[model samples]
Every structure is written in structure tokens, then in C-alpha cells.
Target: MLEKPVNEAPLADVTPPRLEIRNLHRSFEGRAVVDDVSLRVMPGQVTCLLGPSGCGKSTTLRMIAGVEMQDSGQIFVDGKLICDTVFRVPPERREIGLMFQDFALFPHLSVADNVAYGLKGSKADKRARVEELLVRVDLLRFIDGYPHQLSGGEQQRVALARALAPKPRIMLMDEPFSGLDNRLRDGIRDETLAILKEEDTAVLLVTHEPDEAMRMADEIALMRDGKIVQQGAPYNVYTRPIDRASVAFFSDANMLTATVEGALAMTPFGRFLAPGVPDGTAVDIVFRPQHLRIDFDRAGQGPVPTPVDGTPARAVVERARFMGNESLVEFRLDHDGSIMKATVPAVFLPAKGKAMWLTIRRDRCFVFPSEGGA
Candidate 1:
């Protein structure tokens, strides 16, 4: 007799979300600080909240950690509701951990004691957990060292170890690397991420640095005025930004106003067909410096005056700056006084005021609705 085969669940169906925040709202002095924010963090993945100051990223993080009360919203961890209108769990009752930007290590406590402080288990179990976490953060050798005795990176690691001591379901970090020196910050970032990944801990990290967020986050949420403007993988957001502010924040791009005429965008740099653009609409065009090509000719032939095949503007080279690995050339367009920057390899450096043709890679250009503000 043949036995009936058992049905199997898909991986996604079997895996539960580690944390969820729904319609989170908070206010201060009648102004919404965290405005209807919602996000989900899967187990072991790092989600970064990235934005400039006063954008409400930190306030949202604090609400998730239960450090601040939300006027309205729901926060769940491991499929259990922790915050809602009728029920609210205090910070100590919620199984959440936080690492502040200041490191916040106890000045009088030894590293081992600081790490073991959060564990509720017996003395021996707490000591063992602390040692294990210290080893994971590569601070085992400094177990007995006080906060004052350890270097900035070491102290940061100790703080991280302490946060992990209780093995909370989720970890929230508020600009954890912002206060450290540049060199130490990079090292500690790598070390901290590795430890978190190894333990399969879900993390919600907040930062203002675009590069840092891109490098460390599995997914990124860009916030603006207490709202999430864009959220996606780093490459998607950087390469195809949905808004001008996002494009400007992600990379060095020269933004210029352009008039859409027929199927082309008219700029100082000859006319080119605006790929995927609607005709006869005013729009903002973003040209990344890296996409602008510059070539210098020393034969005194004067650089070619090639107008973009589809557009009516012409480009004139204004200045060139050699920045070690690459040369940035500034160009003036005939239609406006606005200057455009193009980044070329150092080997292609052009003389100042040299006549050079400019061409933008239409495929890489980003066009967004003119939002007036940067």
C-alpha cells in the first residue's frame, strides 16, 4: 500500500516576522513627531532608518523600544502585541534591547559586570552569558577592564555585549556609531553587525549617513518630515530615486530645471530625449557627476561643440578639479547660469576653461516632479 504524501509549507509561510510596528503615531506640542509610521523587521535582517535630523527616525525607534509612549499605534514582537490603545508594556517588561549613540557604559563597573547586569538568570548563568557575548564582540580579553580603561571601540563593543546579554527578541540602535572616531567607527560597525547576524537578532538601526546605511542595511527606509518617503534595498533607492531629495541625499548629483519639449528635455547641454518622460511638462533633472564624460584634446582643435541629438542646449567647460582618484569638471550651460559637475577618471583631467563637449547618460538620468525644495 502506498502512503499519502504530507504537504509542505513554503519557507516564507513557515518563518514568522520578528517585529512589527503598525500605524505608529506620536506627537509633541500638538505636532506629530512620528506620523503613522509602519515597518516590519524579519528575523536576523538589519533594517536601517535613514534621514536627516528632525525627520522623526529616532522618535520612531524610541517608541519601538518602549522608551517613549506612542499616542496611537501597535508594536508587536515575536507575534505578541506589546503596545496598543488598551494595553501598554513598559520598557522593562518588553523584550527589547537598545544601544544608544553615547555607548552609555557604566563608569564604575567592570566590562564583565556591565554586560552581566541585564541577565535575570542565576549568578553562574549570567556570568557565562556575559563571557560568551564578550567573546563574540572580541572583548573577552578586556573583561575586567573598567569603562575608563577601554578604548572607544572597546567600550562600544562592551555596550553592545550588555544589550545582547538578555537575548531580547529585537535590538534597536540609535546612531550607535555616530560618536566614535571615523577609523574606530568603521571597525566597530563591522564587528557589531557580525555579532548580531551570528545570533540571528533582528535589528532596527538609525543613521544619517547614506554610505553607512547602504553598507550595513539589508533594507533602508528614508524618512522625511515624520513620514517614510522611500523604503527599499539600497541599490534600488540610490539608482532610481523616486524624489529629488532622495536623489540628492544618495549621491552627488547636479540638479537643474528643465523644460520638457516634445520628447526631449531642453538644458544648456544640447537636447536629449528624456527617456520615459512625458512631453511638455516641467521637471527636475538630476545628472550624476559620475555619469558625465569628459575628454581633453591638446591639439588646439578646441573641443567639439556637439549638441545633444534631441535637445537645444550646449555645454562649455568651466573648471576642472583633480581629487586623487578622479577629476571633477564643472561646465556651464548656455540656457542658464547654473553649472553642472562631471566626474571623470584622473587620467582624463581637462585644463581649466578648456572647451569640452558634455553628454549625459540618459539611461542613468533621474527625472522627478519639481518639488521646489532641496
Candidate 2:
């Protein structure tokens, strides 16, 4: 027989998904709270469920953590089933760690004891683990201190160390940094992210703040009315929103309404391509406040059109206010008297009632079919 070529060994698969949820549903008084929610979190990745209040994000987290039973759903970890309508797994056995708004550290327990509470090993082994986590969190000096002796941010760090003591496969954090001051929150969040990435633990964070989601999440699931309306990377979710509400969720948005004809919607800004929208259908043009270009009015006439910024429109400054890094200028259009907002970087304060020229960036704007036909 001829010599056979040697076959290469197959590569071993790394850790399967750290967490997965399928068709999770929960209701309160016959009203669906978390309706058909599904998501996946891989090892070393952070998935943020972001939305406004009463959007069922917290409930979804609770179900995944096994704190609440889902009316119908399946929960899995590393390709192994953990929970479903028939089967059940207790919260402690699921290997899912939780960090909530309240630090919830035992007032009586020392910092070292708190971090070692969930660990199971000999005295030497548990002590080693506690010391390791305390050093990582930069709280080794407070190892013997009680929870009441630490600041809010320090308490939170201790809580985080305790949660990770057992090396949970999945971590669920519900507004964990909300208690910290604004300046401290930023630093704590970044430090926490680094530690979680080092541990390679999958994280599901719930927050109503858009900035928080954009800053921390690898993937954002935007929820509304107990349903996930959009899910994607932060840049994609902000740049290519599915609807008007989605755009407004991230930042302040301006709108222009026009009727579609020949697959084009004509507005005060310029003509916008309305492809796939039927002729005579109404369309709403949306853009962020930062997309508007401001120009000084000359002799009561606006600046000429350019390729980047389309036809200029005249408006009277209704109000202007300094907003730290930018100045917010509200205007009333000369044509329809409708209000619109624009943001100028640095210091560019215009007197109220001053005439100004505004041009919209056609490339940055989105035209969507209008439901109200306004």
C-alpha cells in the first residue's frame, strides 16, 4: 500500500458560551414583563441590556441568575442545560455571580472574610484566594476592616472581589456603579472591566444610561416596553438605528417631515433618497443635533450650498446655553416656525433672536417612513 499522509490533529474547542438564554418570558398580573427575551454572552465579553425604566431589563437578569423563575425559557452554560420550564437550578449552584446597586456586604464580616465566604478549600487555600483578590482590588490594606468603615466606592470594590472569589462562570451586575460619585464611577467602571476581562468571566450588565452602555458594552441590547427593539455593537446601534425612537434613545435628535415622490423626499434641508418607500408615502428625516452646520448670517441671507452640507435654511435663535464642552442653540425656522436644536463645540454663544444660517449634513441624516404622516 502507498504511504498515507499524516492527518493533523483537530484543535480543541475552547470554553463554550458562558451564558445563553432562549425565549425567556416573565409576567406580572397577566402583563408580560420580559417577553421572549434571548441573548448570548461569550467568555471574556460584556453584554449590556440597556433601556429606560420599566423595560424588563432587571427582570431578565434576575431570571438568568436563577433568582426568579421564568414563565417559559431555557438557560444554558457551557453547552449544558441549567434551567427550563421543567427542570430547575438553584441560584447558588448555577455559578452565576451577582452585584447589585447595593453593595450588600455583611456589616459584621471583615473584608477578607467577605471575599472568602463563597470559597471552599483548606484554611491556607481560602486565605490565599482572599489575599489574591484583595490585592487585585487594591484593598489589601483593608483586609481586616469592616464594611461600615469603607467608603461607598471601596465597599463596591470589596463586593466585586467577593463576587469573583469563587470564579463564577457568569457575572450579572445591575447598576453596580450607580452608588458611586460621577468622578469615581468612571474610574471604578474601567477598573472593574479590566478585572473581569482578566478573569475571562462573561458579564451581563443592566443599565438605563446610554453612555454607560456605549462605554462598557461589546454588545448592546436596547429594550423597550419589555421587548428588545434593537441589538448590536454601540457604533452600529447609534449610526444605523432601526427607528426614530432608537435614534432619540442615544442622544438628542432633530426631525424634518416630507412627502415621498419618485422615491425621493424633499425637505427644507435637501432632497433625501427614500428608496423602497412607496411614492406619496410620508417620510421623516432624522439627524442628531451635532450634524447641523451653523453659519453667520450675512445681509439676512444664508450661506450657499455645498456637497457636504446641503441647501442652507434660515432660522432665528430662540435660546442658547453653554453645555460644558458645547453650546446648545435652539432655533425657530423662518419657513414654518418649528423648533430645532444644534450644538457647537467650545464657545460659540449667540444672542437670542439673532438670525443664523443652518445647513444639514445629508450624509449623516436618515430618512424613514413616517407612521403619523406628519
Candidate 3:
């Protein structure tokens, strides 16, 4: 069981965001796709909207880019109201650059011409700007290459360069790396982030991968069926999820239900003292895999205690899996069929089906009321 922190910072800030959505709503076929959603994207920061498929993340992004009309609410970019009930701005006039999942490049146009297509300047000036953007995106050598001649990663870079041609104030990316393989995706994402940071462009990215969001975002907004359930800094959301779904999606956690007894919790595994929990209250504890350390004794040791004071519940190892440099062990409790996952160093990994002792760090756990389903 983790002890709750005594003090935490407030989530909302007083300063205005560079991009703001107020009471945003959208619907299709009488079904609400984006229902009463609101968010803020700070200048020069990457904010990721994450959720499962059909969760309205894409709808929200399209609405912000002016590609889709909102049924209600207002959208402001840099304090300029671009969307309202009666007033609607076309996508071209929104000062927002968009990069789609598919690299939508003109097949007949050269890479350089594609990048220069949207610039409002003389021919020579436009060509010069295109060359600069191509170099910034690390695709200067492929300026003359056609879309078919370039690799997937190369094509993605060209598309990004084209989006940056107008030097828009904000960029909207819809799963820009989802089409590429894992290795290429990593490299391209890094390059893209570097270029965006250098340009200081405010970006709102939509993706379903939690790891991607954790790795690339300054802030994350977790959405459900058309509604944002939680939004905060990456670390804040990971360490302190507001609900069970957020907790499971953000990390690998062993969730167990128990009832609080004084400061202690009584579960089938054993009794544990959980700080900040009221007595007689039913609660669920989220234990991260990294927080638990397991040690297996080759020479059989005596049975491990249920609760090791100052820590959380204890269990014996039921199985262990060797994963490269580390080992993942699953433990079964003495009192219940509940299982917990723990990651330990390869050197200290227990033998498969062997008995091992487990200890959970109290400071690293998160507790919530037992409300069932993840």
C-alpha cells in the first residue's frame, strides 16, 4: 500500500493557454462524438490527447483545426476566437498546420515543390524557404525525390516540412508515426520533436498509445467516450491517476480490493497499514511492478511474513519470466487467488515455479475507492 502525499500542486493554472477550448461539443448521426470537452495547450509545449479507438480524440483534433465544425462551444487560438456558434473560420485561415496519419503528399510534385506549395512569397523566396525547411527536417538531400522514391520515414519528413512551410502558430498531428515501423517511428518522432521545439510551435497530438504519450508529451489528456476524464503533467498523471482506467492504462499495476482497518487494510493476502485511508472504508490499491522487489533463496528459506511493516502486502512467487536484462515475476497470495507482477534484476531472478519473497514500497503505491472495473 502506498502512502498518499500530504501536499500536491493544483492542476489548473492562472495563466491563459495558447490554445483554449471551452465547452467544446460535436455530434454525428445523433451520437455525441466530442461531448462537453475543454482543454488548454500551452505555447511551445506538446499536449497529447490519448484514449482507445472511437474515443473522440481525432474528432477533437479536427474541431480544433477547423476541419470539423463544433456543434457548440468556443475555440480560441492566441486569444483570437476562431470558433463559435455563429462565427466559423475556414481551415486555411486558422493559422494551424496539420499532419495526417497518411503522408498526404502530391504524387506528381517533387519534395521541394510540395514543401513550397503553401508559402505566400516570390518563386525564388519560396524555393529558398523550402530548402531551409527540408534541411530542418533532415530531408534536404531528397528535395528532388518523388513521393514514391522516398522511404516511409523520408516521406513523413517531407510531409512535416510541408506542414511547416507556412510557419503556422500551432500544429495538429493525428497519429503521425502510427504508419511507420517501431524503429523508424522512434527516429522520426525524435527528429519531429526537435524541429517543433526549435520552431517553438504549440502542438496538439492525438494518439492511443500510452507509452507514446508518456514519452513525447509535456501534458496528457486521457479521454473516454467523448469526454476527457483526466488531464495533467505526464509524471503527475502516472503517479496519481484519478480513476482505475487511468491507472491501468498508464502502467502495469496489481489492483486488489480490501477494507481499511484503522490505518491498516485487511485483504485475503494479509493486513497492511495504508496511510490516508479511513477505517472501515473499502478501497483498491494500485501497486506498480517496479515498486516491488523480489528475492529468491536457492537454499530454501523460511516462509515470508504477510506484511513486512512499513511496506505493503507480501506474496510468494508463482511464476517468473526472463525478459532480456530483467525478469518479470508473478506472485500468488496465501489468502486469495489475486496475483501481482514484479520486475527484478536478471541476476536475482527466481527459478520458474520457485518460492520467492516480495516487498512493496509504500511510498510508490496509489490507492482509490473500490469502484470495480478498470
Error of 3 at 181 (Å): 2.0
List runs of model 2 lying over 4 Å from the truth: 1-15
Q: 91-119 in candidate 2: lDDT tens per residue?
A: 88999999999999998899999999999
Clashes of each: 4, 0, 0
Native-referenced Cα lDDT, model 3: 0.84
Please list the residue runs of candidate 3 whose C-alpha ends up more than 4 Å from where it truly belongs after superposition.
1-16, 268-280, 297-316, 347-349
lDDT of each prediction vs. the true structure? 0.82, 0.92, 0.84
How many collisions between residues are there in candidate 2?
Answer: 0
- For candidate 2, the TM-score is 0.95
lDDT of 1 by residue, 1-374 (tens): 97556786545755657989999999999999889999999989999999999999999988888778899989998788989877988889787889988988888888999998888978888888988988788889988989999888888889999999888878999998988999788888998999898879999999999999998999999998999889999888888787788988877888877777777776655565666666667778786899876544445332455433222234567887788998777887645656888887765556656665556656777777567623
For model 1, the superposed segments whose C-alpha errors exceed 4 Å read 1-12, 270-280, 297-317, 347-349
> Candidate 3 lDDT, tens digit per residue, 1-374?
99767797657856567799999999999999999999888788999999999999999998998878899999998888999989988889988999988999999999988998888979989999998998788788888989999999999999999999999889999999999989899889989988998888899999999989998999999999999999999998888888777888866888778888888776543565677877778888777787776655445552455434242344576787788887788888655757889887664556556665556656666677778522
